[model samples]
Target: MSGFGNGRDIISYVALGDSFTEGMNDPYAESTGTGQERYRGWADRLAEHLARTCGEVRYANLAVRGKLIREIVQRQVPRAVELAPDLVTLCAGGNDIIRPGGDPDATARIFEAAVRRLAATGSRIVVFTGMDTGFQPVMRHLRGKIATYNMHLRAVADEHGCDVVDLWSMRVLQDRRAWSGDRLHLSAEGHRRIALRVCELLDACPPADWRDPWPAEEPLPWRAARQDDLHWAREFLVPWIGRRLTGRSSGDGRTAKRPELERLEPARYRN
Candidate 1:
């Protein structure tokens, strides 16, 4: 708001990160879309909220799936600085922190450096801490590392006077339904909740409450849960490991979906 040279209006915004920001697994309602329009994650949802609230908002998302923190810093951060938008939201380093022998300290150093660069532009910067992974079977063991990195992240935000979206404390995300089938990226409901949370951090009136309670449902039987886990490992986890072994990324040869900031049109906003 203040950084936008206007009172309570973010005229322009740029998003930087990985699959989360890119809107993976959150496809458009009309069709299983392709290319730039395929996903509409939290950043896009936040932009929609801004357009509805602030009027004529310009938004850009320079995020790709499977991108590491270093890649984001090397590729997206410089471009974002050049754009010099009124606001920037970054949520990188998750890919790095989840890898084999990943060091949260090293990741935080790179993350902080990126934050410093963005802070210099006088734009309102918002950074996200990793979510509580204790609910995730595959990622639960790395909770300590994520928590360590989050501490450093908070310190970095404090040092730079940036707002922080502390996702670790977002109890809504711990719900199993908040995640996608692959169990890495968030589900559509998850993205919606995150968008609302980000809007709160930005001091904007979100379209709805992020704290809305999920409907109660019966838990899956023991055998069903085990079968689901096995299926997940076969379909998602194995392919992911294969990619790592072959040095391939889901984002290979991919570029930013919205590389340049553009006006957010009401007609383009999807539910």
Candidate 2:
């Protein structure tokens, strides 16, 4: 256990990273909106759980979609330090690692600097490992790179006394249903599961178990699987590639959803 929620009061919390931490593809129940309003990923879910347990928690999420590790460290890390929160979660570097010619070692060095800086603030820090991409189609080829990065992350956590949410080992996320239509971002259910996992790590009472088995489903036929892949390539992969080639990011004009640490009104956010 990280001793996060173990009798200690977390008055303020900040999350920093990329789309994963930004809560992409997981929209709020009542809103089918776009941009900041539409996404409510795991970090938001974790914040809600914390508010329920600790009360009047100040929360800020400084994660934007399509950000790389250097961008996060250079931009969000300073803002987080200024906030001086009691708890912080950092989940960056996936975008960097997945890109062509991306170096895990170089990324780790940058990541370590950020972690070291945040650790200096005496906040309880949580870092996430990249999920095993072995279950993914084209992404499976990068499994070794991701694994190398995960190892580096574990070392960083050990060195900094940070708690790690080991996504690679979380078998629940291996299911195809856990991912969104793009197969890049997580589904709403996936975000929920992550929240439960974080709650467990922090020793807070999760509404349900993260390990609860998903309902069984029949396998897709071979032709259907191929069709789905083709659709994904057309709808998601190609555009993503074009963006990279043209130096246009999905988050080019976007800012963090919750940029400042503000008191969370449970009634306003809770489901």
Candidate 3:
């Protein structure tokens, strides 16, 4: 209400962005092969944490997987502003900069514009830079670009008086366990860690630690690792490339799962 990180209550919160914001990769019951699972990503988990701290809170998630920054600004930002929530978290531009020929600075510019607009509403804004992809096999080449984008993100957040989640600096995410099979979206455990991180930023409740150490790793056999890579390429990478070439998106016609700001409840998804 008064300002973020000052122990002030956040009554309403809205999330906007791409797949990361959309809560992909976190498993849920209703996901029946269409990939539009109501996976409770960090945003939802953060909302639940907020609800626990504030007794009740109104929340909405306008994030849809596979959306670029421009699409988010054109679509989700206005709706979030209309809702006029006390808190808004923006995590986008990953989809745009992930592609082979994408421009990081341009994407950051577009993203900053959206942040400026959202900040105009007097809502406490939360923004995130993309994680370091150097540890991921297929995404390592994008480390530089993602880093550039992260720098831009921090600058924009400073300019707008917005809080930053700072995903880039989260060394725990460098671990493979934080990623899903696609090596992009965060896994369930990963989402939990991120939820805790975002909650720390919001100063919501007892801050959950995201830096918990993972158990000792047993290295996979070379042959099994090769097989896993092949499977990933065939199932995830191929389809992703096909979508890009065909100019299609996973969220083409899909709308936000929780479009309207409403009271948070236990297990909202029926499926």
**Weakest 10 consecutive residues, lDDT, candidate 3?**
1-10
For each candidate, what TM-score against the reference?
Answer: 0.94, 0.94, 0.92
Cα lDDT, all candidates: 0.89, 0.89, 0.84
Which portions of model 1 show Cα errors greater than 4 Å?
A: 1-10, 31-37
If both were scored by TM-score, which would come out higher, candidate 1 or candidate 3?
A: 1
Clashes by residue pair, model 2: none
> Clashes in model 3: which pairs?
none
Model 3 agreement with the true structure over 187-215: per-residue lDDT tens digits: 98899899888777666643557888888
Task: For model 3, state the Cα shift of residue 133 in Å.
Answer: 0.6
lDDT, candidate 2, residue 226?
92
lDDT of 3: 0.84
Q: What's each prediction's clash count?
A: 0, 0, 0
Better of 2 and 3 by lDDT: 2
| Count of backbone collisions in candidate 1 | 0
